[model samples]
Target chain A: AAGVIQSPRHLIKEKRETATLKCYPIPRHDTVYWYQQGPGQDPQFLISFYEKMQSDKGSIPDRFSAQQFSDYHSELNMSSLELGDSALYFCASANQGLYNEQFFGPGTRLTVL
Target chain B: DQQVKQNSPSLSVQEGRISILNCDYTNSMFDYFLWYKKYPAEGPTFLISISSIKDKNEDGRFTVFLNKSAKHLSLHIVPSQPGDSAVYFCAATVYNQGGKLIFGQGTELSVKP
Candidate 1:
Protein backbone atom coordinates (compact mmCIF):
# COMPACT_ATOMS: atom_id res chain seq x y z
CA ALA A 1 0.00 0.00 0.00
CA ALA A 2 3.00 2.25 0.18
CA GLY A 3 3.28 4.75 -2.67
CA VAL A 4 6.18 6.75 -4.02
CA ILE A 5 7.27 9.67 -1.83
CA GLN A 6 8.67 13.04 -2.86
CA SER A 7 10.27 15.74 -0.74
CA PRO A 8 9.50 19.46 -0.43
CA ARG A 9 5.90 19.21 -1.59
CA HIS A 10 6.23 22.82 -2.72
CA LEU A 11 9.38 24.68 -3.72
CA ILE A 12 10.03 28.29 -4.70
CA LYS A 13 13.24 29.49 -6.35
CA GLU A 14 14.57 32.51 -8.17
CA LYS A 15 16.15 32.56 -11.60
CA ARG A 16 19.69 31.10 -11.75
CA GLU A 17 19.17 29.31 -8.44
CA THR A 18 19.41 25.58 -7.84
CA ALA A 19 17.04 23.05 -6.36
CA THR A 20 17.24 19.39 -5.56
CA LEU A 21 14.13 17.24 -5.37
CA LYS A 22 14.30 13.84 -3.73
CA CYS A 23 12.17 10.74 -4.14
CA TYR A 24 11.72 7.53 -2.16
CA PRO A 25 10.15 4.83 -4.24
CA ILE A 26 7.85 2.21 -2.83
CA PRO A 27 9.63 -0.67 -1.18
CA ARG A 28 10.95 -3.30 -3.59
CA HIS A 29 10.21 -1.12 -6.58
CA ASP A 30 13.21 -1.11 -8.91
CA THR A 31 12.27 1.55 -11.42
CA VAL A 32 11.81 5.27 -10.92
CA TYR A 33 10.53 7.90 -13.34
CA TRP A 34 10.26 11.66 -13.25
CA TYR A 35 7.68 13.79 -15.03
CA GLN A 36 6.86 17.46 -15.24
CA GLN A 37 3.41 18.90 -15.76
CA GLY A 38 3.21 22.53 -16.72
CA PRO A 39 -0.02 24.45 -16.27
CA GLY A 40 -2.52 23.47 -18.98
CA GLN A 41 -0.08 20.91 -20.39
CA ASP A 42 0.27 17.19 -20.19
CA PRO A 43 2.80 15.47 -17.93
CA GLN A 44 6.05 15.18 -19.86
CA PHE A 45 8.54 12.43 -19.28
CA LEU A 46 11.79 13.74 -17.89
CA ILE A 47 13.91 10.71 -17.10
CA SER A 48 13.98 7.25 -15.57
CA PHE A 49 16.23 4.88 -13.68
CA TYR A 50 16.21 1.13 -13.39
CA GLU A 51 18.07 -0.61 -10.61
CA LYS A 52 20.12 2.48 -9.88
CA MET A 53 21.13 3.01 -13.47
CA GLN A 54 19.83 5.70 -15.77
CA SER A 55 17.65 3.85 -18.22
CA ASP A 56 15.98 6.53 -20.30
CA LYS A 57 15.73 10.23 -20.89
CA GLY A 58 13.11 12.51 -22.40
CA SER A 59 12.75 16.29 -22.69
CA ILE A 60 14.78 17.09 -19.60
CA PRO A 61 16.82 20.23 -19.96
CA ASP A 62 20.60 20.41 -19.88
CA ARG A 63 20.51 22.29 -16.62
CA PHE A 64 18.74 19.38 -14.99
CA SER A 65 20.44 16.19 -13.84
CA ALA A 66 19.13 13.18 -11.92
CA GLN A 67 20.39 9.94 -10.49
CA GLN A 68 19.27 7.04 -8.39
CA PHE A 69 21.27 6.28 -5.29
CA SER A 70 22.44 2.92 -3.92
CA ASP A 71 19.40 2.74 -1.69
CA TYR A 72 17.17 3.13 -4.76
CA HIS A 73 16.17 6.66 -3.85
CA SER A 74 16.48 9.25 -6.61
CA GLU A 75 17.22 12.94 -6.77
CA LEU A 76 16.57 15.48 -9.49
CA ASN A 77 18.89 18.45 -9.42
CA MET A 78 18.09 21.55 -11.40
CA SER A 79 20.55 24.40 -11.78
CA SER A 80 20.27 27.88 -13.24
CA LEU A 81 16.52 27.54 -13.09
CA GLU A 82 14.32 29.57 -15.37
CA LEU A 83 10.76 30.74 -14.99
CA GLY A 84 9.64 28.24 -17.62
CA ASP A 85 10.80 25.51 -15.25
CA SER A 86 7.86 26.10 -12.96
CA ALA A 87 5.60 23.05 -12.93
CA LEU A 88 4.44 20.10 -10.88
CA TYR A 89 7.15 17.45 -10.67
CA PHE A 90 6.10 13.89 -10.03
CA CYS A 91 8.02 10.75 -9.13
CA ALA A 92 6.68 7.31 -9.95
CA SER A 93 7.89 3.84 -9.11
CA ALA A 94 7.26 0.40 -10.52
CA ASN A 95 8.64 -3.09 -10.62
CA GLN A 96 11.21 -3.08 -13.34
CA GLY A 97 11.14 -5.80 -16.01
CA LEU A 98 7.85 -7.06 -14.61
CA TYR A 99 6.16 -4.02 -16.09
CA ASN A 100 3.83 -3.43 -13.20
CA GLU A 101 1.75 -0.33 -12.64
CA GLN A 102 3.81 2.80 -11.94
CA PHE A 103 2.57 4.38 -8.73
CA PHE A 104 3.01 8.15 -8.51
CA GLY A 105 3.78 10.33 -5.54
CA PRO A 106 1.92 13.45 -4.38
CA GLY A 107 4.22 15.62 -6.51
CA THR A 108 6.37 18.69 -5.84
CA ARG A 109 5.16 22.00 -7.16
CA LEU A 110 8.11 24.10 -8.25
CA THR A 111 7.61 27.81 -8.74
CA VAL A 112 10.54 29.64 -10.37
CA LEU A 113 10.51 33.38 -10.15
CA ASP B 1 5.58 16.54 -31.98
CA GLN B 2 2.69 15.56 -29.75
CA GLN B 3 2.60 11.81 -30.35
CA VAL B 4 -0.29 11.27 -27.98
CA LYS B 5 -3.40 13.41 -27.94
CA GLN B 6 -6.72 13.92 -26.21
CA ASN B 7 -8.85 16.17 -28.35
CA SER B 8 -11.43 16.93 -25.70
CA PRO B 9 -10.34 19.23 -22.91
CA SER B 10 -13.36 18.57 -20.68
CA LEU B 11 -16.61 16.68 -20.40
CA SER B 12 -19.70 16.79 -18.21
CA VAL B 13 -22.13 13.98 -17.47
CA GLN B 14 -25.00 13.50 -15.09
CA GLU B 15 -24.46 11.17 -12.19
CA GLY B 16 -25.66 7.63 -12.95
CA ARG B 17 -24.99 8.22 -16.63
CA ILE B 18 -21.98 7.08 -18.62
CA SER B 19 -18.86 9.10 -19.37
CA ILE B 20 -16.56 8.42 -22.28
CA LEU B 21 -13.10 9.83 -22.85
CA ASN B 22 -11.03 9.32 -25.96
CA CYS B 23 -7.29 9.29 -26.72
CA ASP B 24 -5.14 8.81 -29.79
CA TYR B 25 -1.53 8.01 -30.49
CA THR B 26 0.68 8.16 -33.55
CA ASN B 27 3.33 5.70 -32.48
CA SER B 28 2.74 2.23 -33.80
CA MET B 29 5.49 0.78 -31.66
CA PHE B 30 3.68 1.54 -28.42
CA ASP B 31 2.77 -1.75 -26.78
CA TYR B 32 1.19 -0.61 -23.54
CA PHE B 33 -1.36 2.03 -22.62
CA LEU B 34 -2.75 3.26 -19.34
CA TRP B 35 -5.24 5.68 -17.84
CA TYR B 36 -4.56 7.74 -14.74
CA LYS B 37 -6.94 9.89 -12.70
CA LYS B 38 -5.76 12.96 -10.85
CA TYR B 39 -7.33 15.37 -8.40
CA PRO B 40 -6.39 19.04 -8.39
CA ALA B 41 -3.47 18.77 -5.97
CA GLU B 42 -2.63 15.09 -6.03
CA GLY B 43 -0.53 12.95 -8.28
CA PRO B 44 -2.21 10.76 -10.85
CA THR B 45 -3.53 7.42 -9.72
CA PHE B 46 -3.41 4.44 -12.02
CA LEU B 47 -6.82 3.45 -13.26
CA ILE B 48 -6.69 0.64 -15.82
CA SER B 49 -4.47 -0.48 -18.67
CA ILE B 50 -4.40 -2.64 -21.76
CA SER B 51 -1.51 -4.13 -23.62
CA SER B 52 -1.14 -4.17 -27.39
CA ILE B 53 -2.09 -7.84 -27.37
CA LYS B 54 -5.56 -7.04 -26.04
CA ASP B 55 -8.38 -4.96 -27.44
CA LYS B 56 -10.28 -4.42 -24.22
CA ASN B 57 -9.83 -4.48 -20.46
CA GLU B 58 -12.34 -3.95 -17.68
CA ASP B 59 -12.14 -3.28 -13.98
CA GLY B 60 -15.20 -2.63 -11.87
CA ARG B 61 -17.07 0.35 -13.35
CA PHE B 62 -14.30 1.22 -15.79
CA THR B 63 -13.60 -0.30 -19.19
CA VAL B 64 -10.91 0.50 -21.70
CA PHE B 65 -11.17 -0.22 -25.39
CA LEU B 66 -8.16 -0.17 -27.64
CA ASN B 67 -8.35 -0.02 -31.40
CA LYS B 68 -4.89 -0.89 -32.57
CA SER B 69 -5.62 -0.13 -36.18
CA ALA B 70 -6.84 3.33 -35.34
CA LYS B 71 -4.00 3.90 -32.89
CA HIS B 72 -6.67 4.96 -30.48
CA LEU B 73 -8.02 4.05 -27.03
CA SER B 74 -11.09 5.00 -25.05
CA LEU B 75 -12.10 4.80 -21.39
CA HIS B 76 -15.68 4.37 -20.25
CA ILE B 77 -16.96 5.03 -16.75
CA VAL B 78 -20.38 3.62 -16.04
CA PRO B 79 -22.87 5.01 -13.53
CA SER B 80 -20.76 8.13 -13.24
CA GLN B 81 -20.45 9.40 -9.69
CA PRO B 82 -19.37 12.81 -8.46
CA GLY B 83 -16.39 11.14 -6.84
CA ASP B 84 -15.20 10.08 -10.28
CA SER B 85 -14.82 13.65 -11.40
CA ALA B 86 -11.20 14.51 -12.13
CA VAL B 87 -8.66 14.89 -14.90
CA TYR B 88 -7.93 11.64 -16.72
CA PHE B 89 -4.63 11.23 -18.50
CA CYS B 90 -3.83 8.76 -21.23
CA ALA B 91 -0.31 7.39 -21.45
CA ALA B 92 1.57 4.96 -23.66
CA THR B 93 4.93 3.22 -23.68
CA VAL B 94 6.82 1.94 -26.63
CA TYR B 95 7.97 -1.63 -26.31
CA ASN B 96 11.54 -0.48 -25.92
CA GLN B 97 10.91 2.79 -24.12
CA GLY B 98 12.01 1.18 -20.84
CA GLY B 99 9.34 2.53 -18.49
CA LYS B 100 9.06 6.05 -19.81
CA LEU B 101 5.43 6.99 -20.45
CA ILE B 102 4.38 9.49 -23.05
CA PHE B 103 1.22 11.18 -21.87
CA GLY B 104 -1.57 12.92 -23.70
CA GLN B 105 -3.17 16.16 -22.74
CA GLY B 106 -5.67 15.14 -20.04
CA THR B 107 -9.44 15.37 -20.24
CA GLU B 108 -11.29 16.78 -17.25
CA LEU B 109 -14.56 15.06 -16.42
CA SER B 110 -17.25 16.51 -14.21
CA VAL B 111 -20.03 14.24 -12.98
CA LYS B 112 -22.95 16.35 -11.88
CA PRO B 113 -25.67 15.13 -9.59
Candidate 2:
Protein backbone atom coordinates (compact mmCIF):
# COMPACT_ATOMS: atom_id res chain seq x y z
CA ALA A 1 0.00 0.00 0.00
CA ALA A 2 1.14 3.56 -0.62
CA GLY A 3 1.51 5.08 2.80
CA VAL A 4 3.86 7.38 4.67
CA ILE A 5 6.22 5.89 7.23
CA GLN A 6 7.28 7.39 10.57
CA SER A 7 10.00 6.27 12.90
CA PRO A 8 9.95 5.77 16.65
CA ARG A 9 6.24 5.21 17.08
CA HIS A 10 6.57 6.59 20.63
CA LEU A 11 9.14 8.72 22.41
CA ILE A 12 9.75 10.16 25.83
CA LYS A 13 11.81 13.21 26.56
CA GLU A 14 12.50 15.54 29.43
CA LYS A 15 11.56 19.18 29.50
CA ARG A 16 14.27 21.42 28.05
CA GLU A 17 15.56 18.54 25.98
CA THR A 18 15.49 18.39 22.24
CA ALA A 19 13.66 15.78 20.17
CA THR A 20 13.53 14.78 16.57
CA LEU A 21 10.83 12.86 14.68
CA LYS A 22 11.38 11.47 11.24
CA CYS A 23 9.10 10.68 8.30
CA TYR A 24 9.56 9.19 4.85
CA PRO A 25 7.02 10.11 2.28
CA ILE A 26 5.59 7.72 -0.25
CA PRO A 27 7.64 7.30 -3.39
CA ARG A 28 7.17 10.13 -5.93
CA HIS A 29 5.36 12.43 -3.51
CA ASP A 30 6.72 15.98 -3.43
CA THR A 31 4.70 17.71 -0.72
CA VAL A 32 5.15 16.80 2.93
CA TYR A 33 3.18 18.08 5.87
CA TRP A 34 3.44 17.82 9.62
CA TYR A 35 0.71 18.24 12.23
CA GLN A 36 0.37 18.08 15.98
CA GLN A 37 -2.68 16.64 17.72
CA GLY A 38 -3.16 17.42 21.37
CA PRO A 39 -5.59 15.60 23.59
CA GLY A 40 -9.22 16.24 22.65
CA GLN A 41 -8.13 18.70 19.95
CA ASP A 42 -7.99 18.66 16.21
CA PRO A 43 -4.75 18.06 14.43
CA GLN A 44 -3.16 21.45 13.83
CA PHE A 45 -0.86 22.07 10.90
CA LEU A 46 2.70 22.77 11.94
CA ILE A 47 4.49 23.27 8.65
CA SER A 48 4.63 22.12 5.07
CA PHE A 49 7.57 21.44 2.81
CA TYR A 50 7.61 21.37 -0.96
CA GLU A 51 10.54 20.84 -3.28
CA LYS A 52 12.83 20.61 -0.28
CA MET A 53 11.87 24.11 0.85
CA GLN A 54 9.54 25.53 3.46
CA SER A 55 6.37 26.63 1.71
CA ASP A 56 3.94 27.35 4.58
CA LYS A 57 3.99 27.27 8.33
CA GLY A 58 1.04 27.14 10.69
CA SER A 59 0.54 28.97 14.00
CA ILE A 60 3.11 26.88 15.84
CA PRO A 61 5.97 28.43 17.70
CA ASP A 62 9.48 28.88 16.34
CA ARG A 63 10.67 26.14 18.66
CA PHE A 64 9.07 23.74 16.19
CA SER A 65 10.77 23.27 12.83
CA ALA A 66 10.61 20.81 9.95
CA GLN A 67 12.95 20.03 7.10
CA GLN A 68 12.68 17.99 3.94
CA PHE A 69 15.84 16.57 2.45
CA SER A 70 16.60 15.48 -1.10
CA ASP A 71 15.72 11.90 -0.26
CA TYR A 72 12.14 13.02 0.43
CA HIS A 73 12.60 12.19 4.09
CA SER A 74 11.45 14.90 6.48
CA GLU A 75 12.30 15.60 10.07
CA LEU A 76 10.52 17.59 12.73
CA ASN A 77 12.88 19.05 15.29
CA MET A 78 11.76 20.54 18.54
CA SER A 79 14.16 22.75 20.48
CA SER A 80 13.77 23.22 24.20
CA LEU A 81 10.81 20.94 24.40
CA GLU A 82 8.25 21.99 26.99
CA LEU A 83 5.61 20.05 28.84
CA GLY A 84 2.91 21.37 26.60
CA ASP A 85 4.81 20.17 23.58
CA SER A 86 3.80 16.59 24.32
CA ALA A 87 1.43 15.45 21.61
CA LEU A 88 0.99 13.08 18.71
CA TYR A 89 2.92 14.24 15.64
CA PHE A 90 1.83 13.05 12.23
CA CYS A 91 3.61 13.22 8.88
CA ALA A 92 1.84 13.09 5.57
CA SER A 93 2.83 12.82 1.92
CA ALA A 94 0.86 14.01 -1.06
CA ASN A 95 1.29 14.48 -4.76
CA GLN A 96 0.63 18.10 -5.62
CA GLY A 97 -1.77 17.12 -8.34
CA LEU A 98 -3.75 14.91 -5.99
CA TYR A 99 -4.08 17.52 -3.27
CA ASN A 100 -7.47 16.30 -2.21
CA GLU A 101 -6.14 13.08 -0.74
CA GLN A 102 -3.10 12.88 1.52
CA PHE A 103 -1.83 9.61 2.95
CA PHE A 104 -0.69 9.92 6.56
CA GLY A 105 1.83 8.08 8.66
CA PRO A 106 0.92 6.26 11.82
CA GLY A 107 2.28 9.22 13.83
CA THR A 108 4.69 9.47 16.74
CA ARG A 109 3.38 10.09 20.20
CA LEU A 110 5.71 12.34 22.15
CA THR A 111 5.60 12.62 25.89
CA VAL A 112 7.65 15.27 27.66
CA LEU A 113 8.09 15.08 31.39
CA ASP B 1 -10.01 30.99 15.10
CA GLN B 2 -11.15 27.48 14.25
CA GLN B 3 -12.11 27.19 10.62
CA VAL B 4 -13.58 23.70 10.92
CA LYS B 5 -15.76 22.63 13.80
CA GLN B 6 -17.31 19.27 14.78
CA ASN B 7 -19.97 20.08 17.35
CA SER B 8 -20.57 16.52 18.54
CA PRO B 9 -17.93 15.03 20.78
CA SER B 10 -19.22 11.46 20.50
CA LEU B 11 -21.97 9.37 18.96
CA SER B 12 -23.19 5.82 19.52
CA VAL B 13 -24.95 3.77 16.87
CA GLN B 14 -26.18 0.22 16.61
CA GLU B 15 -24.93 -2.17 14.01
CA GLY B 16 -26.67 -1.96 10.62
CA ARG B 17 -27.90 1.53 11.46
CA ILE B 18 -27.12 4.83 9.81
CA SER B 19 -24.52 7.13 11.36
CA ILE B 20 -24.45 10.80 10.52
CA LEU B 21 -21.48 12.99 11.38
CA ASN B 22 -21.77 16.73 10.99
CA CYS B 23 -19.16 19.46 10.47
CA ASP B 24 -19.32 23.22 10.05
CA TYR B 25 -16.73 25.61 8.74
CA THR B 26 -16.39 29.35 9.10
CA ASN B 27 -14.33 29.94 5.97
CA SER B 28 -16.41 30.50 2.87
CA MET B 29 -13.35 30.25 0.69
CA PHE B 30 -12.91 26.58 1.46
CA ASP B 31 -14.00 24.59 -1.55
CA TYR B 32 -12.92 21.07 -0.68
CA PHE B 33 -14.06 18.93 2.23
CA LEU B 34 -12.96 15.48 3.43
CA TRP B 35 -13.62 12.94 6.16
CA TYR B 36 -11.05 10.73 7.86
CA LYS B 37 -11.29 7.82 10.25
CA LYS B 38 -8.62 7.40 12.91
CA TYR B 39 -8.28 4.38 15.12
CA PRO B 40 -6.50 4.48 18.42
CA ALA B 41 -2.71 4.62 18.07
CA GLU B 42 -2.89 5.11 14.32
CA GLY B 43 -2.96 8.02 11.93
CA PRO B 44 -6.21 8.95 10.24
CA THR B 45 -7.18 7.24 7.00
CA PHE B 46 -9.00 9.03 4.22
CA LEU B 47 -12.68 8.16 4.01
CA ILE B 48 -14.53 10.38 1.54
CA SER B 49 -14.43 13.85 0.00
CA ILE B 50 -16.61 16.38 -1.80
CA SER B 51 -15.98 19.56 -3.77
CA SER B 52 -17.85 22.83 -3.72
CA ILE B 53 -19.14 22.29 -7.21
CA LYS B 54 -21.08 19.25 -6.10
CA ASP B 55 -23.50 18.81 -3.23
CA LYS B 56 -22.95 15.09 -2.72
CA ASN B 57 -20.28 12.45 -3.24
CA GLU B 58 -20.65 8.76 -2.57
CA ASP B 59 -18.27 5.84 -2.17
CA GLY B 60 -19.63 2.38 -1.42
CA ARG B 61 -21.55 2.76 1.84
CA PHE B 62 -20.00 6.12 2.75
CA THR B 63 -21.44 9.39 1.50
CA VAL B 64 -20.52 13.03 1.94
CA PHE B 65 -23.08 15.81 1.57
CA LEU B 66 -22.13 19.46 1.30
CA ASN B 67 -24.48 22.38 1.97
CA LYS B 68 -22.53 25.36 0.72
CA SER B 69 -25.19 27.90 1.65
CA ALA B 70 -24.83 26.95 5.30
CA LYS B 71 -21.11 26.20 5.13
CA HIS B 72 -21.85 22.76 6.49
CA LEU B 73 -21.13 19.18 5.50
CA SER B 74 -22.07 15.74 6.74
CA LEU B 75 -20.77 12.19 6.46
CA HIS B 76 -23.19 9.31 6.42
CA ILE B 77 -22.20 5.70 7.00
CA VAL B 78 -24.92 3.16 6.38
CA PRO B 79 -25.01 -0.33 7.88
CA SER B 80 -22.47 0.66 10.50
CA GLN B 81 -20.40 -2.16 11.88
CA PRO B 82 -18.37 -2.56 15.02
CA GLY B 83 -15.24 -2.29 12.93
CA ASP B 84 -16.36 1.18 11.93
CA SER B 85 -15.93 2.47 15.45
CA ALA B 86 -13.28 5.14 15.42
CA VAL B 87 -12.64 8.85 15.72
CA TYR B 88 -13.87 10.74 12.68
CA PHE B 89 -12.33 14.03 11.66
CA CYS B 90 -13.69 16.65 9.26
CA ALA B 91 -11.25 18.69 7.19
CA ALA B 92 -11.45 21.47 4.63
CA THR B 93 -9.05 22.99 2.14
CA VAL B 94 -8.94 26.52 0.73
CA TYR B 95 -7.55 27.52 -2.67
CA ASN B 96 -6.28 23.99 -3.21
CA GLN B 97 -2.65 24.76 -2.60
CA GLY B 98 -0.94 21.42 -2.01
CA GLY B 99 -3.82 20.26 0.20
CA LYS B 100 -3.39 22.37 3.29
CA LEU B 101 -6.24 20.85 5.27
CA ILE B 102 -7.77 22.64 8.24
CA PHE B 103 -9.34 20.03 10.48
CA GLY B 104 -12.13 20.05 13.05
CA GLN B 105 -11.96 18.51 16.50
CA GLY B 106 -12.81 14.87 15.78
CA THR B 107 -16.03 13.14 16.78
CA GLU B 108 -15.75 9.71 18.35
CA LEU B 109 -18.20 7.17 16.89
CA SER B 110 -18.99 3.94 18.64
CA VAL B 111 -20.68 1.27 16.59
CA LYS B 112 -22.33 -1.16 18.95
CA PRO B 113 -22.81 -4.66 17.65
Which candidate achieves the best lDDT against the true structure? 1
List per-model TM-scores for chain B. Answer: 0.98, 0.97
| Candidate 1 residue lDDT tens string, A43-113 | 99999999999999999999999999999999999999999999999999999875538889999999999
Clashing pairs in 2: none
| Model 2 interface DockQ | 0.77
Task: Tell me the tens digit of each residue's lDDT in model 1 across B31-102.
Answer: 889999999878999999899889999999999999999988999999899999999999998897786888
Put down candidate 2 lDDT per residue, A3-108, tens digits, no spaces: 8999889999999999999999999999999999998778898889988998788877888778999998999999899999989999988887777788899999
Instruction: List candidate 1 segments past 4 Å from native.
Output: none
Q: What are the candidates' individual DockQ scores?
A: 0.76, 0.77
Query: In model 2, how large is the Cα lDDT of residue A20?
Result: 92
What TM-score would chain A of each candidate receive against the reference chain A? 0.97, 0.97
What DockQ does predicted model 1 obtain? 0.76
The TM-scores, one per candidate, come to 0.98, 0.97
lDDT of 2 at B52: 82
